[model samples]
Target: MAGAGLKGARERRVRTGGIELCVAELGDADRPTVLLVHGYPDSKEVWSEVAVRLAEEFHVVLYDVRGHGRSTAPAPLRGGFTLEKLTDDFLAVADAVSPDRPVHLVGHDWGSVQSWEFVTVPRTEGRIASFTSLSGPSLDHFGHWIKSRMARPTPRRIGQLLGQGAKSWYVYLLQTPVLPELAWRGPLGKRWPKLLERVEKVPAGDYPTPSLPQDAATGAWLYRDNVRARLSRPRPDAFAHVPVQLITPTGDAFLSERLYDDLGTWVPELTRRTLPAKHWVPRTRPDQLSAWIGDFVRTHEEPATRAPRPVAEAAVRSGVRPEYAERFGGQLVLVTGAASGIGRATAFAFAEAGARVVAVDRDAEGAARTAEMARLIGAPEAWGEAVDVSDEQAMEKLAATVAAEYGIVDVLVNNAGIGLTGSFLETTSEEWKRVLDVNLWGVIHGCRIFGAQMAARGQGGHIVNTASAAAFQPSRALPAYNTSKAAVLMLSECLRAELAGRSIGVSAICPGIVNTNITATTRFAGVSDTAEEKRRQRKASRLYGLRNYPPEKVADAILGAVLHDRAVVPVTPEARGVHALSRLAPGALRALARWQPPA
Candidate 1:
């Protein structure tokens, strides 16, 4: 309890600047050293989940800043928590732990604030090998950011300044004299963990140890001692001397992504990473943070690893959005119905973002070909699985095999479905059941099986269900198809609501019509002769071809839906128009649905 789940860790103390800093070490010391620094209102235990993970490959070190956790508080708390003093504590810890080797530095929030000081200043230049900053900006850089905006004062700059000012309301609060201390030592501290659980979606656990109250109370000095002084008279020469990896949580409540727009000027060797998470990502997203940190450390530690492989360069050369690469890199993505058309295109899109892809379809050869091409496109790893999504036992087996071999799926795209064009009375019971089985039940099976795994993992994920514009816009000729798609749309909405608390996003993709093989294979119900069904299929395919809305566009929409966590997405102009009509003029849609198409 005291260490808050930092098992098998060896602890020691290093004296610096009139205080003893509590340092905890894990893994082999002879390996590369990775030193982790904690943020405001937290302790070394804040890095417990991440430290243990990185320790598998490197010597991981975590320490309490003075006056936090088990570390002795400064005699005079007012003047003690300065960046200057914090830098000294860092050097002392580095020297005590890895005296001969430079340590890779990682910091979150206030820890990142101080670590920026440790990396930029001349005194600790050679001691730090690399710096990874999360959720915190160098106060010096922030100061410069403010001055540039004030000097230009353009409309956009003014808006950005106002937006950031609003987010910093809490910073203004912390500058208050005794209220912060009183609130922390009183009710606020008691409710902080629950507050994080509700607001940040940080999982409940043994964190924010009992020392939190005192830590929060004294941590107020972190802002007080440094903010005003550094912002007003920021060092002109404050530039990072080490390779820097800045991991920005796009949804951070405090910092704006715009804060780092000009960061390239200050950090010469910079790698930017973004995640769709909140401010407290160290706890909420430790797995991702650890993976990024370890990868960065390894690349920096061994120069041979820094050279870009052909696969690593392919995404850039192929012109995928950099944000997608940053957000989805190394994530596991599973796409159902991936043998051809929209499903294949969607799989390739995610593959281009560096996701490990699992392409599932009934056609084993087609699925394997999709997987092979996906790896060539940019995916680090990919595999093909043959299974009919309508089969529940097969899906269960697929899920189990994927978990055992590949890992928990981070994104599941239920893009598999069938085409059935027939009026309700014309469609036979067998035909209706077959359409619903694949078009509706396939999505149901994938969601029920894979979604459970995501929720149970508790790390959060995305689920995309490929519904259709027929879901909202009814047509007599497409009764069975519309019924099945409508069910999927409603199911996605319901799942989205239920999974909101778990951080899982569910999206229903509704494309009006696209050129895909489904059209050529659609069943024209009530048709007795095989020749008649073939003619109908040819006519439908020709009509779709004349419209010429490519499946690639629908694939792009699916990626965007997952990226933005949209509830319902209409891809093409026709789909958008129908969606609007369904909402605004339902009777108009009904009239249109009643009109028969040319035979």
Candidate 2:
């Protein structure tokens, strides 16, 4: 019991329904109690990572379900794991752990399945404060969902049913009489951990404890006793009495995201969050899970009369965009050069998706304006920071401040840049230094500072670097700008390869000529006087304005690149064409590069 991998946990035994349950406690008992329940083929150790994190602010408790870890199994395996008995086990654990106070419930997989019962049943009302469920759905709601789809038999419904049926292939196998038990007690149990590590990306360690063989062998009764009967006639009165947070793993192999389509009807107060992860999220994505769980628990820890409102209601009140809300909601996003152009537009896009934004720019007033607009656009929280991204010390301080005040950044956008136009020989050393400082060095500083925080946190994150069409498509008139952007593009590719195993994604977003203010400030190196440089700037700005491409489109491309984990994304039509031609027709690109533009 002591070697279950939960450090500093106090162990205890609870007798309920003729089984001795193994319960572990962390943090001060007087704090708000957070009860963690493990899923099938797992034990209390499954919650070990999350428990340690939650213990800082709450009294965290985790227990083995009957027959799983150290808990004793019922006499007969046939009818031992019913929902009713599981409910009793939960109530008994709740009473023993936090007798005077209602415990906030958190569950994963089958643990969530049964906790749904504990939260919905009339007998357990007021005993549980709130519930956070992951990768699992209520069997009753699932039953009704299946029935409605089957009865209707429309093309879409039939397709959803078939898709879900295919995902549930393992369920059918588990329902077989003695085969599942025999397999689990034999080679299957021996290889289960390796399979999870390879397929689910779950870290290999003390999890899926040595008790797995017997635990899985006996846990078959969980499905055998309940699934068939429940699906045939699900309880219609199953409605949640408390607020529920559903964390859906978008990459979960066993469950379809559509299963929770109508979940709002069953639970009056529902918050939906989606993670880009596979099923064993407890092991693979503990940092994000712990943060979400802690946030949900803390919000609900308030008195019942003033419990924090559901995220959907808050989003509606705050005018958050519904599209991609599940993916970006409550995530922290930091964008450099967020004061104007593609940076500002990208900040607004993430704001609309409900991300908390840190708008950073060298211009203090511009950054502040962007942050204010971001708040109005739907970011739950937004802040402005004035820092030159080219300055490593400034970026380091900014990173420390953001981490201290806003937790680890989930997305970093290195979009700050300066433009210079001249032939290779005409471009001066000063002009090259200035352009590289802002474009190349700025991106380097951003990646080094914020990216380190993401990697150190051990949770996955994404980085977006704004390159230009000239990165791959050569332009003799824009030698300094082209060189800087090309370096950025290559750096992004290198970082993407280096960070792949750490779950950090890097994307280089290359945009063609767009109507933005960069042209207005672009330096012309060959100009003999300030007046000539000004004239050249005006001419370039006019040309870009005539093209009339919007920065918002580039912003959309940036978001899409991160979502898809793309390495190199060319945004506009011409950019895509040139990117292709650069590889397939180098002579054509070189010929095009030689053409001089009107000054």
Candidate 3:
């Protein structure tokens, strides 16, 4: 208990090349290491939160790069801040720190730029297991885009004004004769955070920016050399072989996200994430940032003997296979109304993850196609059956057959449903029954049959029901669809409460308008085959004015709910607004239902 991980970390000083870097060593040295590199005007203290969390599993190495923090900055610092020079500094640090093993590298802001260059270098290629770039662009691409865009008057004016024009005061003072060193060592000693606020526009309460004479000049020199193209450069294509993860902060005012638009083209193994934070995302969102890093490291950074093929090589040399959740592998997954759209996709996601998928749909061939995709994704087994989930006997028999063949059901996705688009007056009694039968009754049947056995056996399981944004906020044009989905939401909530003491979990997936075959399946009061009639139907659908998301994204959300035990999974931004509307003003929402195509 005394050596209870990083609760007892040791601090030390190490020489990386010419610089004496201050380093903190945490966790067991035998575990895979995480090299946390700090950015400009900041120190390794920024990674305190992340280090503490990762220390339970990883050997965390936090170091102040070069001139920043407690590191010694020798004379003639101008030539030492180039990207190549920074790469040398990182390589030196890694060699001194973890000489025997490949390390997982994570960096933010200026450190991200350094990590991007360091990981792709031929000499350091095998030394690094994976790289996580936070709030930094690919240097070559950023340089190219900036240079190309500066040719235009408007953009050049904006770029120069923000990057150099407004910063001339501080840049001048940093390059000044006598004032900088005296100012830093004297009255400006404790005012580095406030000074950075005025110059970098970072708020005082945000990330702390440490300052020193040599460090300021060395840090600024990176941009100076970049603008002048004075640094040794590798072709942008060099990074294509490296495994890179990018986390972009949407609220980062200084950097434009457009820099990563063509990122996939450069690094084929790129895993991109967008966080809702400022430029100093690592300091502000350490928990989320560290979680992503942990996942990347755990997945990729095994021992050298078990060194997984770089994702880039695995992608090109062979076909990339879908990775499955632990609950899905070789286990039975039931998907209802699997003939088309999200049902088809849910079956495929499970199959791709190596589950024995049972795809049931009223349409025989459609169900077969879903089953086929599961097989293509290397599922342990896949079965396609034509059965109406609303039919109790058919669902019971389907459940029995799956149990007989695949042991027990572990995951059940109730995605079978039909959509109706018309006002309450326009919707007939018969139409209401049909929609309810498929959407509400279908989920009820699946849960009752499969869930009973799962609860009886005392084996934990998951249930996913496909509802809609309309469930919470009724759409003016689709009363029947809204009512059916509303029932599904309540059903899931009630099931979750009943099964809470048991190990069973339930989720209601509320999706916004998805670009699936659902709209095509909407049955008009009278059937039409004429071109004009079809054109009018298409036009009405267009007037509905919904953002059509892809089926895959919705499927991902569904799977995420099961894996994470999330109660209500809302797919789109529209769904979020609907949930808020229902929460704040129910009366207003009900009144607005009279409005045509209420968004």
Candidate 4:
């Protein structure tokens, strides 16, 4: 109940259809207005988390539908609460709030339902500038969708209909006359909050106002008045006149993703975004919601100011697929060791996908360059931070600054590491410590600090730790490196298991040997002659160059691993072969480890 109230909000009342709506405004009225609509059993306060965040950039507005919150209900709830009345309430609020300028409309659940009506219908055309919809579809669109599916009746189409029908169980229940109202006014009202927290993971805030019981009771009329009528005979000319941003929560309990598969047919300009969240996204994923909503609204409002960059060439150069853009666009991604090689390629890839990139590395100049190129590629924003991942305090400070400046990170890559090559007996304690500090401890610091931030946010995230194939396939020439990488592999596996419940995925990437500058600077222990060590370094570099495995492929593997939740991805043919051989025949790997390379 803590976040159940709005802060510093100026409140007003707008009367439209015999009932008055309670409206709250935040931020400067001069800015583009972002009007938020709430769903069934919820007031505008359901958007408390998101509205406060959006207020930083836009004029944020939230209103209680006539029957909910501080708003006055109709003389009789039965005949009120239809989409038509809802549209009237929306327009009244819009005119009262912004009058001259069109408002950017954002809706969740029931709010989204009525908003769909607002954007598509003829009357509300010029009033709404843009619409960002999540967890709700237009009733008219829904009607056509069902009719199309029923008419076709293929096995796949039938499955989709059934899947959607099962998800609409609550919608059906809401249509019952006095039963839903009775339930809401009684025990169901008392248990609803905890049920939402447990099932939807909606953060407890100034939401689900005390008017919940009555709101839920009267809210039943929304479905009772609309669903059957609209579904049976949806309006034919229901095409959207404005740009539509559809945000789908993949895990929504009340809606099926398949419902919007053919949404492109109705809207000329459409942008699609998907969230790995439940039904109540505004409460559960506010940071993500605010960022996306702000971006979408800004792009449409100031097209001249936010002009397109030359990303077509960058996209081709980076080899980024369109599918990745759908998933990572607008997400904040942080990568350590992002200055060069695999890390640089990975940063560029995410940038091409339209992510905000934070490039961190010990080489400050390199990191800055990477960030600059990331922005050029397609990242809306990019920054460079200099830090040694081995330094725990530095890493902690970096995490704090990133969170304060960039919002919560949606993806984190622990790719910083140092290479040490030597037999276990010949390797000095100092050399072993150096390798362990940068390789093993660096990953520990990153995972602990950033992973904690991701967990505390309660929104899901992904972590990628760069390991090596030497972890599974033993190597006599690389004892310290193998040990450190082995620990990282095991750590990644353990973290994956523990963080699964929190919806954080951990992936360990193991590349056998790719052409990277790490080999040029690799330490060769037990060789006292500096010239001989340099010669060995050159030889190793040459061997890797001959192998010619590009880091871009490894970067691709890293992205794919995160996308698919793959545990251990061994990149390069040799890495894959060694990984398989180790699993099938351990003795062969051990025998191979004993054959030492010439000094």
lDDT of each: 0.89, 0.87, 0.70, 0.87
TM-scores of all models?
Answer: 0.81, 0.77, 0.50, 0.90
Pairs of colliding residues, candidate 3: none
The root-mean-square deviation over C-alpha atoms between each candidate and the true structure, in angstroms, is 4.5, 5.6, 14.7, 3.2
Q: How much is 510 displaced in model 2, in angstroms?
A: 5.2
lDDT of 1 by residue, 1-599 (tens): 23777988999989998899889999999888999999998999989989988887889999998999999989788889899999989999999999988999999999999999998999997898899999999999999999999999999999999999999998899999999999999999999999988777777889878899989999999999999999998889999999999999877989999999999999999988877678988887776687678767866885533434445445443598876777776678899999998999999888888777999999999999999988888776689999999999999999999988777788999998889887789999999999899999999999999999888765678999999998998898889999999999999999999999878999999998799989888888888889999998999888899999988899888888888889999988988999999899999999989988766
Candidate 2 lDDT over 235-280, as tens digits, reads: 9999999999999987788999999998998999898898767787
Output the lDDT of residue 204, model 4. 65
Instruction: At residue 229, give the lDDT of candidate 3.
Output: 57
Compare the candidates by TM-score and give the number of the best one: 4
Clashes of 4: 6
- 13-67, model 3: which lDDT tens digit per residue? 7775577877778888888889998766567766776787788778899877777
lDDT of 4 by residue, 389-489 (tens): 99999998999999987787888999988888888889999999999999999999999999998887666789999999988977888889999999999
Query: Model 3: what TM-score?
Result: 0.50
Q: Which stretches of candidate 2 lie over 4 Å from their true place?
A: 1-3, 303-317, 330-412, 428-463, 469-477, 483-557, 560-599
